[model samples]
Target chain A: MINIILNNRQESIDVDSMTVQELLNHKNFTFKLLVVKINGKLIKRDSYDEAVIRDGDEVTVLHLVSGG
Target chain B: MSEMIDTKIRQHLSRFRVGIAGCGGLGSNCGVALARVGIGELVIVDFDVVEKSNLNRQYYFLKQVGLPKTEALQHNISLIDPTVRITSHNTTIKSDNVAELFGGCDVVVEAFDRADQKVMLIESMSLLLPDTPLISGSGMAGWGNNHLIRCEQYGNLYVCGDQQTEVSPDVPPLAPRVGIVASMQANFVMEILMRKKV
Candidate 1:
């Protein structure tokens, strides 16, 4: 089990490790214009598939799009 | 005391500079609101030219249809406050140049229409201008959810919108809701500027 903070909430997930992309999928964050950060560091869109999320990592997925 | 506070806020506003990336629905309206409130300077960038369809929500007149959006917005803002200095850029805002364009601004408003563009600005500004706040609009399509339109902050980023309303054939970006979110973004800039002074 992995205990991590999603947004500002705490959650315990079944996986011990996963990619940022997988974490986003697990949380169902389908918003296209999302900015992801792990432990205060930004994970660029192209790096999402490579960036790893582990136990107790603070992951932030922010949806910053509504249209102009 | 209230009058003194107002005077101080005005002083702060008059010394501040803001950047508006993309002079469209959100940028044009936000720029005008900030100018009306006496913001000292605005750095606006947009590559597109104003079209007849833009008049529906953008702060542009029919006569300015062929003009670049940045130029049209600058002209419109000047009409509101002649003292407000504006530097208009008739170019696209990309990730690599975010810092070069808006590095000196106290705050930047990300007002792009497409999701990809919004993400580009938000991510670039968050990284390049780590100290400056980026206020953005999201989910302001249709109308009448005044209560739902709110500001959410994430580090140096501020997003204003319903956070769900995507612009589509069915739910198009209208003036009322777009103005609401844009006004909120402008208002947040004032709040940030005032707080910085304190």
Candidate 2:
């Protein structure tokens, strides 16, 4: 298991081969326009599959909906 | 005017260049604030147009409905401060082109409506202009606790909004709430220009 902050809240999750893509699917974030960051570093859409999530990483998932 | 802002600060503000990414509620409102304070130049970028619906928040005249947002906003900003050198870009912005489009800007404001564009602007600018401050908005939807609409800085990025609230059809982005966030974003720009840590 690993600890991470999801959207500013602390949570523990299984660490088995966990990647940002898997973590997003596991949490069921349905929004298409998402800004994913781990420890304040942006994870672009292409790298989601390869970006790994580590223990104690601060993850921020922000949605940029179509409105101003 | 000197009573509102010191002459020295006002003089310094006239030398800053601000680039706004969207011209809807956030972009238009933020531009107006900066223009009123006499920010020298503004590059307003948006491909959309004013509609009857936009009257609720965006800056535009009823007669200017069909005009592109960039054009309409430039006209409006000029009304606030004729000396403001305004450039309007009627084009779509992508990660590949944002840096090129906004390269001359001292501070680039992320006023986009979509999440992807906001993130793209931030990421692209971080790569292309790492030292430039990027101000963005998030979570200001509906009539939220206005006090929650405060400024937060992460590295070179400064954001003003209630970071988690969102707007929906039922809970639209009301005038007062949106204006407050826009004003706060403009305040951050001035602070950065003045070298004040506020």
Candidate 3:
């Protein structure tokens, strides 16, 4: 088990290493306009599957909602 | 005989140009407010036409129901202040032309309604115009959550909205709520423009 800070909140995941896509799915972050940043580095949409997040990584998933 | 005293502030405001990404609810209303506030130049882009339904929240008149949004908005702003330069592009904003369109502006306003489009604008702008500030709106639908609407800053991106209210059948985009967010976006643009160079 590894603990990571997700959006200013710490959460314990059952994996030592997981891709950004995996972390998003695990957290159920299905927002279409989410901007993901791992350790202050932005992860592009295409690179989500390749970007890996390890223990103690700081991740911020900003949900940009749909409206006007 | 120059009959002017506070020409410094007006001249300062007339030196900057702002770009509007989508001339829908937020864009239309924000554009009007900026124009009224004496923004020097406005670069607006929109491929959609004004419909009767847009009259609810958008800043358009009944006579402009069939006109293109960019043209109609240009005319409205001209009526407000003909001296204000309005350069409008009546076309769809894609990633390829995003920089060419708004690269020169001091600030860009992302007023798109769709989440995908918002993402596209933010991604393209962040890559193309890294230094330019982007003011966007999200979740300004329906009403009664006036207190929830707020502005958040992330790097150069400033988003003004509740950040949660997704538009659905139950939560439609009304005037007051949309206006609140639009005013916030315009206010941000004003603040960015009014800042001293450092």
Q: Which structure is stronger by lDDT: 1 or 2?
A: 1
**Under CAPRI classification, how is model 1 graded?**
medium
Model 2: per-residue Cα lDDT over B58-130, one tens digit each: 8787999898899888888777779999988899988788878889988888887766677788788867787
* Top TM-score hit: 1
TM-score of 3: 0.87
**Candidate 1 residue lDDT tens string, A1-68:** 99998876898999879999998888788877788888867899899999999999988788765568
lDDT per residue (tens digit) for residues A1-68 in model 3 = 88888876889999889999998899888876787777756789899999999999888778887887
The CA lDDT at B174 in model 3 is 89
Winning candidate number (DockQ)? 1
- On the 0 to 100 scale, the lDDT of residue B182 in model 2 is 83
**What does DockQ come to for candidate 3?**
0.58
The sequence of per-residue lDDT tens digits that candidate 3 reaches over residues B1-198 is: 243534555577788899999899999999999988778899999999999999999999999999999999999999998988999999999999999999889999999988888888888887789789999898888889778999977767888999899899998998999999999999999898889452
lDDT on C-alpha atoms for all candidate structures: 0.87, 0.82, 0.88
Clashes of 1: 3
Model 1 per-residue lDDT tens digits across residues B1-198: 998876666677999999999999999999999998888899999999999998889999999999999888888887877899998889888888899999889999989999888888877876777788889888899878788988877767788998888888888898999999899999999889877862
Q: Give the root-mean-square deviation of each candidate in angstroms.
A: 2.1, 3.4, 3.4
Error of 2 at B84 (Å): 1.2
Predicted complex 2: DockQ = 0.39
